[model samples]
Target: MQCPRCHNLMVEQSFEDLRDDTGSLCFKGWRCITCGEVLDPLILSNRAAHREPMSGRARQKRSFIQIGS
Candidate 1:
């Protein structure tokens, strides 16, 4: 597949640790040789799952305050 960033050919490669958080992270993903862009589906889904949902009422109050000021 072509890279979204550089539009170059993406090569399938295995990596050790992309994030390098705590333990070793081993996953196979597509890598762009031209711009060094990595696309990993697992990481994307993991991030979405780990994302915090915003508080509705608090957010609304903050928005009102900002608008008034």
Candidate 2:
């Protein structure tokens, strides 16, 4: 992938513990080495149904917490 801001190539990386009150999934985060932009693969897919494309670095650092039923 390419960084939307700098147009630099992005590097793929794994991120663990991505969840909330609604549960989560093991996802990947892409980061642009040039502009420090981070994109969450999961969020992009989920929001694609309703929202516009996601952009820029990770504004909120999100992590998953196992939910106990």
Candidate 3:
């Protein structure tokens, strides 16, 4: 599989959750070799559900107010 963040090759790997509350300790996921990004089933679903559409508006710059300088 290809990574979404870096567009690199991803490898299958097993991950262990030590403090799992659902009683499953081991899970299978994919990891990007270049960017070290991990993706699991739960993570993928959550991201898909919460995805937002991109807009054409440019971002505004913020001014920082320094105190006691």
lDDT scores of the candidates, listed in order: 0.85, 0.72, 0.81
C-alpha TM-score for every candidate: 0.49, 0.52, 0.64
User: Could you tell me which residue pairs clash in candidate 3?
Assistant: none
Residue pairs with colliding backbones in model 2 are 17-64, 18-64, 19-64
Q: lDDT per residue, candidate 3, 1-69, as tens digits?
A: 999999999999999887746775888999999999999988999988986545422221122223323
Residues 1-69 of candidate 1 have per-residue lDDT tens digits of 889889999999987874646777878889999999888878668867886557876898899999999
User: lDDT (0-100) at residue 57 of candidate 3?
Assistant: 24
Model 2, C-alpha of 43: deviation from truth (Å): 2.8
Best TM-score among the predictions, by candidate number: 3
True-vs-predicted CA distance for residue 13, candidate 2, Å: 0.5
Question: Where is model 3 more than 4 Å wrong at Cα?
Answer: 20-24, 53-69
Cα error, residue 44 of model 1, in Å, equals: 3.9
Could you tell me how far off, in angstroms, the CA of residue 50 lies in candidate 3 after the best superposition? 2.0
Which has the higher TM-score value, candidate number 1 or candidate number 3?
3
